[model samples]
Target: MTDNPAPAVVEPIPKWHEFMVPVLRVLSDGKPRTRRDSLTATLDEAGMTEEQRAVMLSSGQPKAENRIGWAMSDLTRAIAVAKPERGSFVITDLGKDLLQKNPYAITQEILRNIPAYRDYEPQRQNVSKADPVDIAVEDSELDPTEQIERGIQLLRADLATDLLKRLQERHPDFFEEAVVKLLLTMGYGGAENRGRRIGGSGDGGVDGVIDQDALGLDQIYIQAKRYAPDITVGREAFQSFVGALAGRGATRGVFITTSRFSAGAIEYAKSIPTRIILINGKQLTELMIRHGVGVQIAKTYTVAEIDEDFFE
Candidate 1:
């Protein structure tokens, strides 16, 4: 074989608008179709090549498939299709009537005309333009530049959820260490003020602590939990944590869990005299992901615009 191989030819992916009508048509019968079936139906009807199907996005999702997914999302937003179940969707009565009219192109203009889409307009910037069709093609909820940021935000959310699941699988000691590392990432401690994991050492209710200053005058106690979602942290846990802080003669504490806090738990934390910060499963993962404690940068892209100052 030659050292140089021919570059694989990449095929084009259709825009979101191109997939809208096909998605509507696939769901028009009112029979529930699964997510995979729906995407396949649209792509098949549109006659995309295998090369196009094989193309992958930076997020590892197929570009054409992602755009098709966006089309289905747009349809659901317009109430053109109803997702009555988790993975499957059915055409609503409104959707059926819409299919009967047979719009040549079920464009965003048609979608925005729906009352639900209009209801969201008050919060959006007032862009008084005569052409509704142009808004769909030209205007982005976030501009084209911002679309990159939006995609990265979505990717990070998926990664965070995965990291939380993995964290739950680890040992309690690991969880305590992860929280300390996360705190360090959040600027809680530096060379002068170091954090320590004390859970495995039979430390009291407190699992870890971060000395806030070099002199160690102030410290933040941590109580870490690797509980599942079904296991909610109740008020008792918070009260015990407060008692631990009292034992340490400390006023600041952080209660972190890989599960949600019960309503009573949240209330008790607020009512406690000590400063108790609650970090539930969702919040914990978000913080870790934000501070780069458990995750690493996969890729980076720099987007630049014309510097107005340079032009002046």
Candidate 2:
């Protein structure tokens, strides 16, 4: 009889509440502690497993360590812990006073009751426990620079997805125009409108042509297929496209498709001597967003900070 396979290793995932008291204890000394030194010793003292200590979050930090950081943050908001010198911190009177009570538990309820933390309690309470990203995002807003950049990134990401969906719904001609506009905005075609749509029945897979310069002689061919999500352009399609390019004596081409290119098609393009840049639906939308092809700016915000050089 064959031996049974060993069971899968189950990594320890501790809830945030489990780390609260341990983090509080690490700062109970009332003396200032450097960021790195305290976190290193705190988790081990709390009896965290080696694997748990080593477990990384999506951001590549140890999960237990991340929770501990959040624990400190919550405590800091309540004035239980005070950050004195950049990453160094000390336990405040409020923190030591709390420890005098229920030294074992420093619950979220207790933290919010304090005046300093109460002001920000509503935003924290609004975050759903079901979504881990919610609180993390809320916490990331603590830094001025990170908050603004994070908001922009979230907006751009949503726009890219929405753009792709809208493109798939629009007319084929619209998609073609979008591809051309994106290239134009990227400075491929100059002020003379070097890109022209030539896609038709006898076009032999070539959809458009872009003049790298104002001159009409040198050309970069474009083959855009507004395919359904389920359709994947394969090697045979690439062979036909490359053949069409060769027929026109063109060595450079862009193959833009609403659907994906098959692995074989991508590999073939990589192996070929000719220059063929592939743009699938995802990348096409991303490029459009970057080049401002079809989207308009909705709102803009300007965040300002003190200019330290002005003080000098």
| Most accurate candidate by TM-score | 1
Best by lDDT: 1
Candidate 2, residue 40: the lDDT equals 79
lDDT of 2 by residue, 54-81 (tens): 7787768888887777667667656677
lDDT of 1: 0.76
Residue 140 miss distance in model 1 (angstroms): 5.7
Model 1 residue 222 lDDT score: 93
Mark the 10 consecutive residues where model 2 has the least summed lDDT: 117-126
The TM-scores of all predictions, comma-separated, are 0.59, 0.54
lDDT of each structure? 0.76, 0.74
Off by over 4 Å in 1: 1-141, 307-312
Clashes of 2: 0
